[model samples]
Target: MTKPANTQLTDARRGDARADRTTFLWTAAFIFAGMTVTILSAATELQRANSAFPVGKVVLYEITGFLSFLAMFPLIAWLVTRSTPGQHSWRQVIPVHLAASLGVVILHVSLFVLLRKALVPVFFGEPYFFTDNLARDFIYEYRKSVLAYGIVLFAITFGRELEQKRRELAAAREDAKKSHRLTLKCGGRSIFVDASDVIWAKSASNYVEVKTPGAEHLARATLASIERQLGDAGANAVRVHRSWIVNADYISRIEPTGEGDLKIEMKDGATVPGSRRYRGNLNLS
Candidate 1:
Protein backbone atom coordinates (compact mmCIF):
# COMPACT_ATOMS: atom_id res chain seq x y z
CA MET A 1 0.00 0.00 0.00
CA THR A 2 1.11 3.54 -0.67
CA LYS A 3 2.15 5.72 2.28
CA PRO A 4 0.14 8.81 3.12
CA ALA A 5 1.20 12.30 2.00
CA ASN A 6 3.87 14.14 4.02
CA THR A 7 2.36 17.62 3.90
CA GLN A 8 2.16 17.85 7.68
CA LEU A 9 5.79 16.75 7.96
CA THR A 10 6.90 19.44 5.54
CA ASP A 11 4.88 22.11 7.33
CA ALA A 12 6.29 21.07 10.71
CA ARG A 13 9.83 21.49 9.39
CA ARG A 14 8.95 24.95 8.04
CA GLY A 15 7.43 25.93 11.39
CA ASP A 16 10.54 24.80 13.25
CA ALA A 17 12.73 26.86 10.94
CA ARG A 18 10.57 29.93 11.49
CA ALA A 19 10.62 29.50 15.26
CA ASP A 20 14.42 29.17 15.28
CA ARG A 21 14.82 32.36 13.27
CA THR A 22 12.51 34.26 15.63
CA THR A 23 14.36 33.02 18.73
CA PHE A 24 17.74 33.97 17.26
CA LEU A 25 16.57 37.50 16.39
CA TRP A 26 15.11 37.98 19.87
CA THR A 27 18.38 36.84 21.52
CA ALA A 28 20.46 39.27 19.49
CA ALA A 29 18.07 42.13 20.25
CA PHE A 30 18.23 41.39 23.97
CA ILE A 31 22.04 41.41 23.94
CA PHE A 32 22.16 44.77 22.11
CA ALA A 33 19.57 46.27 24.46
CA GLY A 34 21.46 44.92 27.47
CA MET A 35 24.69 46.52 26.25
CA THR A 36 22.95 49.87 25.66
CA VAL A 37 21.51 49.75 29.17
CA THR A 38 24.93 48.96 30.66
CA ILE A 39 26.53 51.87 28.86
CA LEU A 40 23.87 54.35 29.97
CA SER A 41 23.92 53.11 33.56
CA ALA A 42 27.73 53.28 33.73
CA ALA A 43 27.73 56.84 32.39
CA THR A 44 25.15 57.86 35.01
CA GLU A 45 27.18 56.33 37.86
CA LEU A 46 30.46 57.89 36.70
CA GLN A 47 28.84 61.35 36.37
CA ARG A 48 27.45 61.18 39.91
CA ALA A 49 30.73 59.94 41.47
CA ASN A 50 33.13 62.21 39.57
CA SER A 51 31.70 65.41 38.13
CA ALA A 52 35.05 66.27 36.55
CA PHE A 53 35.41 62.89 34.75
CA PRO A 54 36.48 63.27 31.09
CA VAL A 55 33.35 62.76 28.90
CA GLY A 56 35.53 61.24 26.16
CA LYS A 57 37.00 58.62 28.53
CA VAL A 58 33.59 57.67 29.92
CA VAL A 59 32.26 57.26 26.36
CA LEU A 60 35.27 55.14 25.46
CA TYR A 61 34.74 52.88 28.51
CA GLU A 62 31.04 52.33 27.69
CA ILE A 63 31.82 51.66 24.02
CA THR A 64 34.23 48.90 25.11
CA GLY A 65 31.44 47.37 27.23
CA PHE A 66 29.17 47.29 24.17
CA LEU A 67 31.82 45.59 22.05
CA SER A 68 32.35 42.99 24.79
CA PHE A 69 28.82 41.57 24.60
CA LEU A 70 28.84 42.05 20.86
CA ALA A 71 31.57 39.44 20.78
CA MET A 72 30.31 37.20 23.63
CA PHE A 73 26.60 36.71 22.79
CA PRO A 74 27.33 34.89 19.52
CA LEU A 75 29.56 32.48 21.40
CA ILE A 76 26.76 31.90 23.91
CA ALA A 77 24.32 31.12 21.06
CA TRP A 78 26.76 28.65 19.52
CA LEU A 79 27.35 27.01 22.91
CA VAL A 80 23.62 26.69 23.67
CA THR A 81 22.88 25.08 20.30
CA ARG A 82 25.77 22.66 20.48
CA SER A 83 25.21 21.37 24.03
CA THR A 84 22.27 19.89 25.86
CA PRO A 85 22.04 22.09 28.92
CA GLY A 86 20.89 19.92 31.86
CA GLN A 87 22.78 16.86 30.62
CA HIS A 88 26.10 18.34 31.77
CA SER A 89 27.02 18.47 35.43
CA TRP A 90 28.45 21.55 37.14
CA ARG A 91 31.90 19.98 36.97
CA GLN A 92 31.71 19.89 33.18
CA VAL A 93 29.98 23.22 32.62
CA ILE A 94 31.84 25.25 35.21
CA PRO A 95 35.26 24.59 33.68
CA VAL A 96 34.02 25.39 30.19
CA HIS A 97 32.27 28.51 31.45
CA LEU A 98 35.46 29.63 33.26
CA ALA A 99 37.48 29.24 30.08
CA ALA A 100 34.90 31.16 28.02
CA SER A 101 34.70 33.90 30.62
CA LEU A 102 38.45 34.38 30.50
CA GLY A 103 38.39 34.49 26.70
CA VAL A 104 35.71 37.19 26.54
CA VAL A 105 37.44 39.26 29.23
CA ILE A 106 40.71 39.15 27.32
CA LEU A 107 38.97 40.07 24.04
CA HIS A 108 37.12 42.99 25.64
CA VAL A 109 40.23 44.41 27.21
CA SER A 110 42.34 43.92 24.08
CA LEU A 111 39.76 45.66 21.84
CA PHE A 112 39.40 48.56 24.25
CA VAL A 113 43.17 49.08 24.48
CA LEU A 114 43.67 48.88 20.69
CA LEU A 115 40.71 51.14 19.85
CA ARG A 116 41.82 53.72 22.41
CA LYS A 117 45.38 53.70 21.06
CA ALA A 118 44.20 54.42 17.51
CA LEU A 119 41.38 56.88 18.35
CA VAL A 120 43.25 58.73 21.05
CA PRO A 121 46.05 59.58 18.63
CA VAL A 122 43.64 60.98 16.02
CA PHE A 123 41.16 62.73 18.37
CA PHE A 124 42.84 63.32 21.77
CA GLY A 125 46.26 63.89 20.09
CA GLU A 126 47.96 61.71 22.81
CA PRO A 127 48.53 58.09 23.78
CA TYR A 128 45.74 56.29 25.74
CA PHE A 129 46.50 56.41 29.49
CA PHE A 130 46.65 53.22 31.62
CA THR A 131 48.47 52.01 34.72
CA ASP A 132 51.28 49.49 34.26
CA ASN A 133 49.43 47.16 36.72
CA LEU A 134 48.12 44.57 34.21
CA ALA A 135 47.46 41.85 36.76
CA ARG A 136 45.39 44.14 38.98
CA ASP A 137 43.30 45.34 36.00
CA PHE A 138 42.59 41.80 34.74
CA ILE A 139 41.74 40.45 38.19
CA TYR A 140 39.14 43.17 38.76
CA GLU A 141 37.47 42.72 35.32
CA TYR A 142 37.59 38.88 35.30
CA ARG A 143 35.19 38.71 38.26
CA LYS A 144 32.53 40.70 36.36
CA SER A 145 33.17 38.73 33.15
CA VAL A 146 32.53 35.41 34.90
CA LEU A 147 29.23 36.69 36.29
CA ALA A 148 28.10 37.84 32.82
CA TYR A 149 28.94 34.43 31.35
CA GLY A 150 26.73 32.72 33.95
CA ILE A 151 23.85 35.05 33.05
CA VAL A 152 24.29 34.28 29.33
CA LEU A 153 24.09 30.54 29.98
CA PHE A 154 20.98 31.06 32.11
CA ALA A 155 19.23 32.98 29.32
CA ILE A 156 19.97 30.26 26.75
CA THR A 157 18.75 27.52 29.07
CA PHE A 158 15.51 29.35 29.84
CA GLY A 159 14.82 29.95 26.14
CA ARG A 160 15.40 26.28 25.29
CA GLU A 161 13.02 25.14 28.05
CA LEU A 162 10.32 27.43 26.75
CA GLU A 163 10.70 26.12 23.19
CA GLN A 164 10.56 22.50 24.33
CA LYS A 165 7.37 23.10 26.32
CA ARG A 166 5.75 24.77 23.37
CA ARG A 167 6.56 21.79 21.13
CA GLU A 168 5.07 19.29 23.62
CA LEU A 169 1.86 21.28 23.93
CA ALA A 170 1.51 21.48 20.16
CA ALA A 171 2.05 17.73 19.79
CA ALA A 172 -0.63 17.05 22.43
CA ARG A 173 -3.18 19.10 20.49
CA GLU A 174 -2.26 17.39 17.24
CA ASP A 175 -2.71 13.98 18.85
CA ALA A 176 -6.18 14.99 20.09
CA LYS A 177 -7.28 15.71 16.51
CA LYS A 178 -6.48 12.17 15.32
CA SER A 179 -9.82 10.42 15.89
CA HIS A 180 -9.87 7.94 13.00
CA ARG A 181 -7.82 5.28 14.81
CA LEU A 182 -8.21 1.74 16.14
CA THR A 183 -6.29 -0.22 18.75
CA LEU A 184 -5.58 -3.81 17.77
CA LYS A 185 -3.64 -6.63 19.41
CA CYS A 186 -1.04 -8.13 17.11
CA GLY A 187 2.16 -10.09 17.75
CA GLY A 188 1.48 -9.81 21.53
CA ARG A 189 1.39 -6.03 21.45
CA SER A 190 -1.39 -3.46 21.34
CA ILE A 191 -0.86 -1.39 18.19
CA PHE A 192 -2.83 1.55 16.90
CA VAL A 193 -3.88 1.02 13.28
CA ASP A 194 -5.72 3.41 11.04
CA ALA A 195 -9.25 2.26 10.26
CA SER A 196 -8.55 2.81 6.58
CA ASP A 197 -6.27 -0.24 6.57
CA VAL A 198 -9.01 -2.63 7.70
CA ILE A 199 -10.48 -4.63 4.81
CA TRP A 200 -13.12 -6.45 6.87
CA ALA A 201 -14.39 -6.92 10.43
CA LYS A 202 -16.12 -9.78 12.28
CA SER A 203 -17.56 -10.31 15.76
CA ALA A 204 -15.66 -12.39 18.38
CA SER A 205 -17.66 -12.23 21.65
CA ASN A 206 -16.93 -8.86 23.33
CA TYR A 207 -14.17 -8.20 20.77
CA VAL A 208 -13.83 -7.40 17.08
CA GLU A 209 -11.66 -9.35 14.64
CA VAL A 210 -10.24 -6.80 12.24
CA LYS A 211 -9.00 -8.13 8.90
CA THR A 212 -6.49 -6.21 6.83
CA PRO A 213 -4.97 -7.32 3.50
CA GLY A 214 -2.32 -9.50 5.15
CA ALA A 215 -3.41 -10.12 8.75
CA GLU A 216 -6.35 -10.53 11.12
CA HIS A 217 -6.03 -8.72 14.46
CA LEU A 218 -8.08 -8.62 17.67
CA ALA A 219 -9.55 -5.41 19.01
CA ARG A 220 -10.74 -4.99 22.62
CA ALA A 221 -14.00 -3.32 21.48
CA THR A 222 -17.27 -4.90 20.41
CA LEU A 223 -18.07 -5.08 16.69
CA ALA A 224 -20.69 -2.30 17.00
CA SER A 225 -18.27 -0.08 18.90
CA ILE A 226 -15.53 -0.65 16.32
CA GLU A 227 -17.97 0.18 13.52
CA ARG A 228 -19.00 3.46 15.15
CA GLN A 229 -15.40 4.34 16.02
CA LEU A 230 -14.37 3.80 12.40
CA GLY A 231 -17.38 5.69 11.04
CA ASP A 232 -15.35 8.57 9.62
CA ALA A 233 -12.85 6.15 8.06
CA GLY A 234 -15.36 3.78 6.36
CA ALA A 235 -16.31 5.49 3.14
CA ASN A 236 -15.34 2.22 1.40
CA ALA A 237 -16.62 -0.11 4.15
CA VAL A 238 -20.26 -1.20 4.51
CA ARG A 239 -22.05 -3.53 6.92
CA VAL A 240 -22.98 -6.54 4.75
CA HIS A 241 -24.38 -8.59 7.66
CA ARG A 242 -24.80 -8.43 11.44
CA SER A 243 -21.62 -10.58 11.67
CA TRP A 244 -19.46 -8.86 9.07
CA ILE A 245 -18.48 -5.59 7.35
CA VAL A 246 -16.45 -5.50 4.09
CA ASN A 247 -14.23 -2.90 2.48
CA ALA A 248 -15.83 -2.23 -0.94
CA ASP A 249 -12.48 -1.22 -2.41
CA TYR A 250 -11.26 -4.81 -2.01
CA ILE A 251 -14.44 -6.58 -3.21
CA SER A 252 -13.41 -8.89 -6.04
CA ARG A 253 -16.88 -10.31 -6.67
CA ILE A 254 -20.24 -11.03 -5.04
CA GLU A 255 -22.26 -14.15 -5.77
CA PRO A 256 -25.68 -15.41 -4.71
CA THR A 257 -25.69 -18.74 -2.90
CA GLY A 258 -28.32 -21.41 -3.50
CA GLU A 259 -29.12 -21.12 0.23
CA GLY A 260 -30.16 -17.42 -0.32
CA ASP A 261 -27.13 -15.90 1.57
CA LEU A 262 -24.69 -13.71 -0.43
CA LYS A 263 -20.92 -14.33 -0.53
CA ILE A 264 -18.26 -11.60 -0.73
CA GLU A 265 -14.93 -12.53 -2.35
CA MET A 266 -12.13 -10.05 -1.49
CA LYS A 267 -9.13 -9.11 -3.65
CA ASP A 268 -7.03 -11.17 -1.23
CA GLY A 269 -9.15 -14.31 -1.98
CA ALA A 270 -10.97 -14.32 1.37
CA THR A 271 -14.73 -14.91 1.28
CA VAL A 272 -17.04 -13.24 3.85
CA PRO A 273 -20.70 -14.00 4.54
CA GLY A 274 -23.36 -11.39 3.72
CA SER A 275 -26.98 -11.50 4.91
CA ARG A 276 -29.86 -10.65 2.56
CA ARG A 277 -31.25 -8.25 5.18
CA TYR A 278 -28.39 -5.76 4.50
CA ARG A 279 -28.04 -6.67 0.80
CA GLY A 280 -29.06 -3.12 -0.23
CA ASN A 281 -25.82 -1.74 1.33
CA LEU A 282 -23.72 -3.63 -1.25
CA ASN A 283 -24.76 -1.87 -4.48
CA LEU A 284 -21.15 -1.70 -5.61
CA SER A 285 -20.29 -0.74 -9.22
Candidate 2:
Protein backbone atom coordinates (compact mmCIF):
# COMPACT_ATOMS: atom_id res chain seq x y z
CA MET A 1 0.00 0.00 0.00
CA THR A 2 1.05 3.56 -0.65
CA LYS A 3 2.26 5.46 2.41
CA PRO A 4 0.46 8.50 3.74
CA ALA A 5 1.71 11.89 2.51
CA ASN A 6 3.06 12.94 5.91
CA THR A 7 4.62 9.54 6.41
CA GLN A 8 6.24 9.75 3.04
CA LEU A 9 7.76 13.10 3.97
CA THR A 10 9.09 11.73 7.22
CA ASP A 11 10.59 8.75 5.47
CA ALA A 12 12.08 10.90 2.79
CA ARG A 13 13.73 13.06 5.42
CA ARG A 14 15.13 10.03 7.19
CA GLY A 15 16.34 8.65 3.90
CA ASP A 16 18.00 11.90 3.03
CA ALA A 17 19.86 11.98 6.30
CA ARG A 18 20.92 8.39 5.77
CA ALA A 19 22.13 9.23 2.29
CA ASP A 20 24.16 12.09 3.66
CA ARG A 21 25.90 9.78 6.06
CA THR A 22 26.42 7.20 3.33
CA THR A 23 27.79 9.81 0.99
CA PHE A 24 30.33 10.99 3.53
CA LEU A 25 31.54 7.47 4.25
CA TRP A 26 31.68 6.52 0.60
CA THR A 27 33.25 9.74 -0.62
CA ALA A 28 36.41 9.02 1.29
CA ALA A 29 36.65 5.60 -0.32
CA PHE A 30 35.86 7.09 -3.67
CA ILE A 31 38.65 9.63 -3.40
CA PHE A 32 41.14 7.03 -2.23
CA ALA A 33 40.42 4.51 -4.96
CA GLY A 34 40.27 7.29 -7.54
CA MET A 35 43.62 8.67 -6.37
CA THR A 36 45.20 5.25 -6.47
CA VAL A 37 44.11 4.42 -10.01
CA THR A 38 44.89 7.80 -11.53
CA ILE A 39 48.24 7.99 -9.78
CA LEU A 40 49.10 4.49 -11.00
CA SER A 41 48.31 5.49 -14.56
CA ALA A 42 50.41 8.63 -14.29
CA ALA A 43 53.30 6.62 -12.88
CA THR A 44 53.10 4.15 -15.73
CA GLU A 45 53.10 6.87 -18.42
CA LEU A 46 55.96 8.82 -16.83
CA GLN A 47 58.00 5.65 -16.39
CA ARG A 48 57.46 4.82 -20.04
CA ALA A 49 58.79 8.29 -20.89
CA ASN A 50 61.94 7.50 -18.85
CA SER A 51 61.37 10.45 -16.53
CA ALA A 52 62.93 10.29 -13.11
CA PHE A 53 60.71 10.53 -10.01
CA PRO A 54 57.38 9.92 -11.73
CA VAL A 55 56.01 10.12 -8.17
CA GLY A 56 55.62 13.91 -8.42
CA LYS A 57 53.51 13.67 -11.59
CA VAL A 58 51.44 10.97 -9.90
CA VAL A 59 50.84 13.25 -6.90
CA LEU A 60 49.74 16.12 -9.14
CA TYR A 61 47.15 14.05 -11.01
CA GLU A 62 45.93 12.46 -7.78
CA ILE A 63 45.38 15.82 -6.12
CA THR A 64 43.65 17.23 -9.20
CA GLY A 65 41.16 14.37 -9.51
CA PHE A 66 40.47 14.34 -5.78
CA LEU A 67 39.90 18.07 -5.47
CA SER A 68 37.67 18.21 -8.53
CA PHE A 69 35.53 15.37 -7.23
CA LEU A 70 35.28 16.94 -3.80
CA ALA A 71 34.06 20.19 -5.29
CA MET A 72 31.19 18.52 -7.14
CA PHE A 73 30.10 15.80 -4.73
CA PRO A 74 27.96 18.05 -2.49
CA LEU A 75 26.07 19.49 -5.42
CA ILE A 76 25.32 16.00 -6.67
CA ALA A 77 24.28 14.96 -3.19
CA TRP A 78 21.83 17.85 -2.94
CA LEU A 79 20.32 16.99 -6.31
CA VAL A 80 19.81 13.37 -5.36
CA THR A 81 18.23 14.33 -2.03
CA ARG A 82 15.42 16.23 -3.70
CA SER A 83 14.89 13.63 -6.43
CA THR A 84 16.35 10.18 -6.21
CA PRO A 85 17.18 8.08 -9.24
CA GLY A 86 14.17 7.09 -11.37
CA GLN A 87 11.95 9.43 -9.35
CA HIS A 88 10.92 12.83 -10.63
CA SER A 89 8.07 15.17 -9.93
CA TRP A 90 6.21 18.08 -11.58
CA ARG A 91 8.61 20.63 -10.12
CA GLN A 92 10.97 20.94 -13.12
CA VAL A 93 13.33 18.52 -11.46
CA ILE A 94 14.79 17.55 -14.80
CA PRO A 95 15.80 21.05 -15.67
CA VAL A 96 17.27 21.75 -12.25
CA HIS A 97 19.28 18.52 -12.40
CA LEU A 98 20.49 19.35 -15.85
CA ALA A 99 21.75 22.66 -14.56
CA ALA A 100 23.43 20.94 -11.65
CA SER A 101 25.15 18.50 -14.00
CA LEU A 102 26.57 21.41 -15.98
CA GLY A 103 27.66 23.12 -12.79
CA VAL A 104 29.43 19.99 -11.57
CA VAL A 105 31.23 19.56 -14.86
CA ILE A 106 32.26 23.17 -15.02
CA LEU A 107 33.45 23.32 -11.40
CA HIS A 108 35.49 20.15 -11.71
CA VAL A 109 37.06 21.20 -14.96
CA SER A 110 37.84 24.73 -13.84
CA LEU A 111 39.34 23.69 -10.52
CA PHE A 112 41.40 20.91 -12.08
CA VAL A 113 42.75 23.18 -14.77
CA LEU A 114 43.70 25.90 -12.31
CA LEU A 115 45.38 23.48 -9.94
CA ARG A 116 47.23 21.80 -12.79
CA LYS A 117 48.62 25.11 -14.11
CA ALA A 118 49.72 26.21 -10.63
CA LEU A 119 51.09 23.03 -9.07
CA VAL A 120 52.40 20.82 -11.88
CA PRO A 121 55.74 22.64 -12.35
CA VAL A 122 56.59 23.14 -8.64
CA PHE A 123 55.71 19.57 -7.79
CA PHE A 124 56.04 17.48 -10.95
CA GLY A 125 59.21 19.13 -12.38
CA GLU A 126 57.42 19.69 -15.70
CA PRO A 127 55.41 22.44 -17.34
CA TYR A 128 51.63 21.86 -17.42
CA PHE A 129 50.60 22.00 -21.06
CA PHE A 130 47.25 21.00 -22.43
CA THR A 131 48.98 20.37 -25.76
CA ASP A 132 49.11 24.23 -25.86
CA ASN A 133 45.30 24.14 -26.41
CA LEU A 134 42.93 25.28 -23.64
CA ALA A 135 39.83 24.36 -25.64
CA ARG A 136 41.09 20.86 -26.29
CA ASP A 137 41.85 20.32 -22.60
CA PHE A 138 38.42 21.59 -21.59
CA ILE A 139 36.67 19.29 -24.04
CA TYR A 140 38.69 16.24 -23.05
CA GLU A 141 38.27 16.87 -19.33
CA TYR A 142 34.56 17.64 -19.80
CA ARG A 143 34.03 14.06 -20.98
CA LYS A 144 35.53 12.60 -17.83
CA SER A 145 33.79 15.20 -15.67
CA VAL A 146 30.41 14.18 -17.03
CA LEU A 147 31.22 10.54 -16.40
CA ALA A 148 32.26 11.32 -12.82
CA TYR A 149 29.09 13.29 -12.19
CA GLY A 150 27.02 10.39 -13.50
CA ILE A 151 28.72 8.05 -11.11
CA VAL A 152 28.03 10.43 -8.21
CA LEU A 153 24.38 10.62 -9.23
CA PHE A 154 24.13 6.84 -9.27
CA ALA A 155 25.90 6.52 -5.93
CA ILE A 156 23.89 9.17 -4.05
CA THR A 157 20.51 8.12 -5.42
CA PHE A 158 21.14 4.43 -4.91
CA GLY A 159 22.25 5.01 -1.34
CA ARG A 160 19.15 7.03 -0.45
CA GLU A 161 16.78 4.54 -2.04
CA LEU A 162 18.45 1.67 -0.22
CA GLU A 163 18.20 3.47 3.09
CA GLN A 164 14.56 4.27 2.40
CA LYS A 165 13.83 0.63 1.70
CA ARG A 166 15.61 -0.48 4.84
CA ARG A 167 13.65 1.95 7.02
CA GLU A 168 10.36 0.86 5.47
CA LEU A 169 11.22 -2.79 6.06
CA ALA A 170 12.03 -2.03 9.67
CA ALA A 171 8.79 -0.12 10.08
CA ALA A 172 6.86 -3.03 8.59
CA ARG A 173 8.46 -5.38 11.05
CA GLU A 174 7.56 -3.12 13.96
CA ASP A 175 4.02 -2.82 12.71
CA ALA A 176 3.84 -6.61 12.52
CA LYS A 177 4.86 -6.83 16.16
CA LYS A 178 1.89 -4.64 17.06
CA SER A 179 -0.51 -6.11 14.52
CA HIS A 180 -2.32 -8.75 16.59
CA ARG A 181 -3.11 -6.54 19.52
CA LEU A 182 -3.78 -2.95 20.56
CA THR A 183 -4.34 -1.45 24.00
CA LEU A 184 -6.60 1.45 24.80
CA LYS A 185 -6.35 3.36 28.03
CA CYS A 186 -9.62 4.84 29.18
CA GLY A 187 -11.76 5.22 32.31
CA GLY A 188 -8.68 4.72 34.46
CA ARG A 189 -8.28 1.25 33.03
CA SER A 190 -6.49 -0.49 30.20
CA ILE A 191 -8.50 -2.51 27.71
CA PHE A 192 -6.91 -4.86 25.21
CA VAL A 193 -8.54 -5.99 21.98
CA ASP A 194 -7.67 -8.10 18.99
CA ALA A 195 -7.20 -5.61 16.20
CA SER A 196 -8.95 -7.80 13.65
CA ASP A 197 -11.95 -8.49 15.86
CA VAL A 198 -12.99 -4.88 16.10
CA ILE A 199 -16.13 -4.62 13.94
CA TRP A 200 -17.35 -1.04 14.44
CA ALA A 201 -17.53 1.90 16.84
CA LYS A 202 -20.01 4.66 17.65
CA SER A 203 -19.92 7.96 19.48
CA ALA A 204 -21.47 7.81 22.95
CA SER A 205 -21.39 11.35 24.32
CA ASN A 206 -18.11 11.55 26.21
CA TYR A 207 -17.19 7.91 25.51
CA VAL A 208 -16.84 5.63 22.51
CA GLU A 209 -18.60 2.28 22.12
CA VAL A 210 -16.36 -0.21 20.35
CA LYS A 211 -18.19 -3.30 19.09
CA THR A 212 -17.16 -6.75 17.99
CA PRO A 213 -19.54 -9.50 16.98
CA GLY A 214 -19.06 -11.02 20.43
CA ALA A 215 -19.22 -8.00 22.70
CA GLU A 216 -19.04 -4.22 23.07
CA HIS A 217 -16.55 -2.16 25.05
CA LEU A 218 -16.78 1.45 26.11
CA ALA A 219 -13.70 3.68 26.03
CA ARG A 220 -13.44 7.21 27.40
CA ALA A 221 -12.73 8.98 24.15
CA THR A 222 -14.57 10.86 21.46
CA LEU A 223 -15.69 8.99 18.31
CA ALA A 224 -13.62 11.38 16.13
CA SER A 225 -10.55 10.77 18.24
CA ILE A 226 -10.98 6.98 18.24
CA GLU A 227 -11.54 6.97 14.51
CA ARG A 228 -8.18 8.64 14.07
CA GLN A 229 -6.53 6.18 16.45
CA LEU A 230 -8.12 3.22 14.65
CA GLY A 231 -7.12 4.61 11.30
CA ASP A 232 -3.55 4.93 12.51
CA ALA A 233 -3.70 1.27 13.49
CA GLY A 234 -4.93 0.46 9.97
CA ALA A 235 -8.43 -0.42 11.10
CA ASN A 236 -11.14 -0.90 8.49
CA ALA A 237 -13.66 1.15 10.48
CA VAL A 238 -14.74 4.50 9.06
CA ARG A 239 -17.04 7.26 10.24
CA VAL A 240 -20.42 6.96 8.50
CA HIS A 241 -21.94 9.94 10.24
CA ARG A 242 -21.22 12.57 12.88
CA SER A 243 -22.27 10.04 15.48
CA TRP A 244 -21.65 6.65 13.85
CA ILE A 245 -18.91 4.49 12.37
CA VAL A 246 -19.01 1.19 10.47
CA ASN A 247 -16.53 -1.54 9.83
CA ALA A 248 -15.90 -2.28 6.19
CA ASP A 249 -15.48 -6.00 6.91
CA TYR A 250 -18.96 -6.27 8.51
CA ILE A 251 -20.82 -4.31 5.85
CA SER A 252 -23.38 -6.57 4.15
CA ARG A 253 -25.78 -4.10 2.52
CA ILE A 254 -25.97 -0.44 1.58
CA GLU A 255 -29.49 0.91 1.31
CA PRO A 256 -29.63 4.32 -0.34
CA THR A 257 -31.83 6.89 1.37
CA GLY A 258 -33.99 9.00 -0.94
CA GLU A 259 -32.33 12.03 0.56
CA GLY A 260 -29.01 10.83 -0.88
CA ASP A 261 -27.85 9.33 2.44
CA LEU A 262 -27.21 5.64 3.08
CA LYS A 263 -28.33 2.99 5.51
CA ILE A 264 -25.40 0.65 6.09
CA GLU A 265 -26.57 -2.80 7.07
CA MET A 266 -24.12 -5.04 8.89
CA LYS A 267 -23.81 -8.80 8.69
CA ASP A 268 -25.46 -9.08 12.16
CA GLY A 269 -28.57 -7.13 11.02
CA ALA A 270 -27.30 -4.00 12.73
CA THR A 271 -27.51 -0.74 10.82
CA VAL A 272 -25.83 2.66 10.95
CA PRO A 273 -26.95 5.88 9.29
CA GLY A 274 -24.46 6.97 6.67
CA SER A 275 -24.70 10.60 5.74
CA ARG A 276 -24.49 11.83 2.17
CA ARG A 277 -21.32 13.66 3.08
CA TYR A 278 -19.64 10.41 4.05
CA ARG A 279 -21.07 8.30 1.20
CA GLY A 280 -18.13 9.16 -1.01
CA ASN A 281 -15.96 7.27 1.47
CA LEU A 282 -17.87 4.01 0.98
CA ASN A 283 -16.93 1.19 -1.37
CA LEU A 284 -20.41 -0.37 -1.47
CA SER A 285 -20.96 -3.59 -3.33
lDDT score for residue 239 of model 1: 90
Q: Poorest 10 consecutive residues of model 2 by lDDT?
A: 168-177
For model 1 the local lDDT of residue 272 reads: 94
Over 127-185, each residue of candidate 2 has an lDDT whose tens digit, in order, gives 87745787787778778777777777787777876786566445533443466444554
Runs of candidate 2 exceeding 4 Å displacement: 1-11, 89-98, 117-131, 181-285
TM-score, candidate 2, is 0.53
Best by TM-score: 2
lDDT per residue as tens, model 1, 191-283? 666677788889888778888766778865567656665664443778998988877888989999856579899887889998888888888
**Residue 111 error, candidate 2, Å:** 2.2
> Where does candidate 2 clash, by residue pair?
none
